[model samples]
Target: MPNPKITTLIITYNEMDYIQKCIDSIDFTDEIIVVDSYSTDGTYEYLLHHPKVKVIQNPFENFTSQKSFALKQAKNDWVLFLDADEVVPEKLKLEIKSTIENTDCAAFWFYRKFMFQNKPLNYSGWQTDKNYRLFRKSKAKFSDKKIVHETLVVDGKSGILNEKLIHYCYKNYEDYKSKMLKYGRLKAKEDFYKENYFNYLVYILKPAWKFFNHYILRLGILDGKKGLIICYLNALGVLERYKELKRLEKKNELAYHLVMP
Candidate 1:
């Protein structure tokens, strides 16, 4: 088989802190396309001046819509999606190039190592991170109905790569808090719309289960302080989602679902 060319796609909002490094890491790609959500943090300005980067400005929506827009802008048949906070290391880049050249699979998965302040966390349920980031553009697309965690839809065979993709998750507590709150609210709203609302018992047990599953069952304790922090935060996020769902249901203010698309 002939070596295939690939395009790198990224979606961003206020990701200036990680955007430059993320883009620099994927310099081997045939083309890099960034679809920004009119970021006010100068992220758009930086990409605008980069000679090798192509920038497109779009309004902020959910993750699925933003990524779907980026997918359409890709110029090559093989496309790799990278989060603004993710960096493709040299070893992974070489593996990716080699995979596209020899594999006929529709998509390839990469293990991700989540980083906290430049250190990797080998526990906290993060060690199991695997994402399908590389795929043939014609055979794959992101699901349209998701709000928080979006999934890719690949029409054919899939395979996995041995290298790890580095994810610079959050810079600090403030960053983590801000993102989790947003995610919690979005997930709650999605649950409300789907009529998956739960009662008090569920609200209480769900968070507990999340903590136990991630911290104890997943061996998050082995990772020490940072792992504990991650596990607790994960539980708190779950509680917040259920609380938000109940709050909206009590006031009968679920009209927001009508406006969401």
Candidate 2:
């Protein structure tokens, strides 16, 4: 058979729960490259047994660095980046295949359909989410931001795929809180170094606005309990960011004075 035109790339870190489904969805690709962050879980073992997959073990660093490493390791000219908790729907798989074979666009953004507790969340401000996952390897690279929510920067023309990629973002409340705390800390560090500050008005207004925007304006209410939960958690994430930022600022100031004095 002729060589496959696309390479599927994924990065994993203790993603045992979703790794199997993620791998199964992209079996159509010519090549699959998984760069794992030394998962203590059985993720590495599972990938090793998969015949179509090539696994690379690297130490955990930042999202962009890990994804860029995977991008470089891809053998095919076209690359599709998928998270371990995300799967390409069968319809999306066919759409992507057709796009790759027929179109000359360098990149295509896939609409993501997020699920919470196995429920399809039609609102919660998540319906508008789109990601540039399918791209020509030569035309794009991930930004070297030291954060978990980094994005790919593509150099050529890009288009959108109508089909949705299923994204299982959070399984439960505890999982949500755990990620929020970790992400809040990283965001706080970035803001503190950039001399960003939060005032009383912003501290109160930001979270409120976030809830209003996601739940009310974005029609998240239609999604029922899942929408409310997501909106509440999103606001909490914003609040935690401000709290962590202030804490980091105070710590940095104390360290600076002690070292100079």
Candidate 3:
């Protein structure tokens, strides 16, 4: 007749600025498990001293492996995978507490209200942005197939929370651009592993379509300047992805020729 205990899990690297607030927001959780990727910016030390936090310093690997490792460290059956840059609002905190107390599904999806430069982004293909943050550890897991944008596999039914998670996704344009470029490179590597091929035509179409789809079809125009910047950078990220993909193909070709007689 007692409510199930919950563990708030977060994998972080150089997230000192946001870590404190993130933890402060979720202090209601029964336990907080943080799997740090050997952060050098004093983030590791900060978490080490936090009484509520149990920090594990693991070598920097792909997102999938890191998250999967964090998932296993949960002491309770209910696990919430939270990003360091995200904060659980009071309403969301209350919602989560009540949900787990009466949850019927194996997992719960939380829609994120993304923030850019402290402004909430209402569109730009973000209206439907959701992640399976709250879930039963035994019923959900991070799949190791795609390393960068890792997929969460849920064995049973799922539910969606009414309150949106407040996600401070990007501090500024430069910050967002740098992260997206890195993501693009990682995505290219994933595609390379799968032997996915794309020609010159893809380079032109993908980025163009990305911009058009998000800005136009997704009603990003309503968000004005913020939406424009996001859509443009998103397309740039696609271009970066394909550019890296092309470079990878050429590198492989060169290696094959060198090895051949």
Pick the TM-score winner. Answer: 3
- Quote the RMSD, in angstroms, for model 2: 1.9
Model-by-model lDDT, in order? 0.89, 0.86, 0.91
Task: RMSD for all candidates, in order, please.
Answer: 3.3, 1.9, 1.3
Q: Name the lDDT of candidate 1.
A: 0.89
- Give lDDT tens digits, candidate 1, residues 11-53: 9989999999999999999999999999999999999999999
lDDT of 3 by residue, 174-205 (tens): 87899789888888889888999968899899
Cand. 3 Cα-lDDT: 0.91
* Candidate 3, superposed: residue stretches over 4 Å from native: none
Which pairs, if any, clash in model 3? Answer: none
C-alpha lDDT (0 to 100) for residue 32 of candidate 2: 94
Candidate 2 vs candidate 3, TM-score winner:
3
Models ranked on lDDT: 3, 1, 2
lDDT of 2 by residue, 10-92 (tens): 99988898899899999989899999988888999999889999999988666777888888898889999999999988999
Order of candidate numbers by TM-score, starting with the best: 3, 1, 2
Using all chains and alpha carbons, the TM-scores for the candidates as numbered come to 0.93, 0.92, 0.95
